[model samples]
Target: MADFETILERGGALILPTETVYGLFASALNEEAVKGVYQLKRRPLDKALNLNVASLEDILAFSKNQPPYLEKLYQTFLPGPLTLILEANQAVPSWVNSGMASVGFRIPSHPLTLDLIRKCGPLIGPSANLSGQASGLHFDQIQADFKGQVDGFKDDDFLTGQDSTILDLSTSKARILRQGAISKEELVSALPQLIFQD
Candidate 1:
């Protein structure tokens, strides 16, 4: 419904499709724009947000404590449906982490999301639906929550209904926050050596 670059350039959040579902995106480094995402989602300030980066190299800049397990996880699941919560580097905003020291980051498998991130650089893409609601995949499903808040809306067939697997790699332990598209069994099999937390 709107231009991707324009929204990011104007410091506005965008509602776009991901491999999982629709997400509201803003520049990861733009504090004001990131705040706008919270307002649009009606999400609380303390919940924190998720970031979509252009490439693996982009992550190195914001990942302070990249343990060997995380590196293995990156190699195994990145450029796919997974979010890695890690301790943020200096470049990440405190607000992005809800004043916490860590941030959740993802490299989505969706072509459009990747393309947009490549264009605008890194961005924060909170869920497109309202807080504590069903995440939408189509614009019609999302219109109620974000009709007025988002600068643009894009609905592709790929993101009809799915969600990313969440992995917390901030500490020495790899915690499975939520199991979505990526199976817990597969993760364990890939990183058999890494410890899994309850």
Candidate 2:
């Protein structure tokens, strides 16, 4: 935890394992740290990053005016593989959202990642692989691809190699931006109002 704290404080990023896939992580609150992720992955500036929080309270801190239906969704499927897009608060830097009004938040179910988040606060967690490449499912893949690129690597055996299901809840009409561990059918079954955008 101390090492992770030090790395993050110095505007460094980490290759951390999540339940869905290995991710390149940096403090969501730090502009430079978030930028480092973009530099490390060579990700496009136009694409936004998603944040991983320790709890619902952390999500509340970074998001504003969340709908009541989200509470139901959180109760049912948080700390799992769901990334919910909500209205961003001032605490969330514009870079994380790519200057967009909304930001995506996820509470991963992995114990180690959750504990790290508990110690380090919310983190900008995008797939560890470079932009347009397949997401790394194992630590070795991440190491081979990004050994010297990031500041540190936190290894773990991930069960699912897929990404999280991204749902845009910022608008009145809930939409699915990306399908991964959670399917659109599951979301619709869980919340009848959710609409599949893609």
Candidate 3:
């Protein structure tokens, strides 16, 4: 395995496997590194990037407000395949959110991903593929798409081949942005008062 902390500290990006699809990762707080991910993926500057955090405290560092029921939601879905959108605090760079007021944060259930985040701080994790392409679900696919584009690759055999379920908790009511591993019914089952956005 590559020294992920060194690679990130040197402003390099990595192709990291998660419980979901492989992701192109760079230190979320490192503006240059984050920009490199955008450049390599040919992703639009306006599109926001999701962050991978090691813990709830990491999420709190970038969150401006603590919404009601957030703890309950986190307790039920965190360290799994759910991504939460929360109001961004000043700690989060504008580049990560594309100047948006809110940002998406996830704590992947994969141990390797969690370890890397713990070592290098939160990471900007976008699907490891060129813009508009399918997400890379395995190392071979990632290598074919980004072998030369990233600093290093972390190999893992486990992958769910699906992105996290995204929930928008930045507002008073919860809204499902993207359904993946976690279903709307599952979320509603946990929090019946939650509202779904059309």
Candidate 4:
């Protein structure tokens, strides 16, 4: 297993796989690391990155309110390819959330990625690519793009070529921000009570 804790502590960033795509991951607890990710990608500070958490409990910890259908949503789509956006609570650091009231998060299904998150804690994981570029799907493409500048690279098989579906539950009604592995119709079929605006 990679000593991601040390890698993140020293370098502030690493390349790791997610269920959706390889991500330029950094410790959410480390403001400097979070800054590095944005700088590395040339990503605008105004834009927010999604949090990669170990489990459902972590999601609840960072979020403001626990919706009644959260469990059902998790059961149906999580550890799969769903990125959920929720209202952030006090526990979520401003650096991680960029002071946005809403925070996006994922529970990655890829075993190695999941293990790293479980052992090292929450990470802010954006797709491994420069800002405005298409997300890399293969390890070689990412490695070539990053040009050996990062501390570590854990390559793996493509779990899914598509990005995770971005579902916003921050408001009273649910909305689909970005459609990916999961579909809006699927969400409606699974959780019938909630209204959806795609």
For candidate 3, the TM-score is: 0.94
**lDDT, model 1:** 0.80
User: Is candidate 1 or 3 superior in lDDT?
Assistant: 3
TM-score of 1: 0.92
**Rank by lDDT (best first):** 3, 4, 2, 1
Pairs that clash in candidate 2: none
Runs with alpha carbons beyond 4 Å of true place in candidate 1: none
lDDT agreement with native, every candidate: 0.80, 0.83, 0.86, 0.85
Please give, for residues 1-198, the per-residue lDDT of candidate 3 as tens digits.
458788999889988888898888899888999999999999999999988897888888889776767778888888998999999988888999998999999888888878989888789988898999888786887797775778888788878898889888898777888889999999889988777666
Candidate 4: count the clashes. Answer: 0
Error of 1 at 121 (Å): 2.2
The collision pairs in model 4 are none
Off by over 4 Å in 3: none
Over 83-185, each residue of candidate 1 has an lDDT whose tens digit, in order, gives: 8888888878787887677888888777888998998868988778888988766577688766676777677776647688888878877888888888889
> After superposing candidate 4, which stretches have Cα over 4 Å from the reference?
none
lDDT: which candidate is best?
3
Q: Give the range where candidate 2 is weakest over 10 consecutive residues by summed lDDT.
A: 189-198
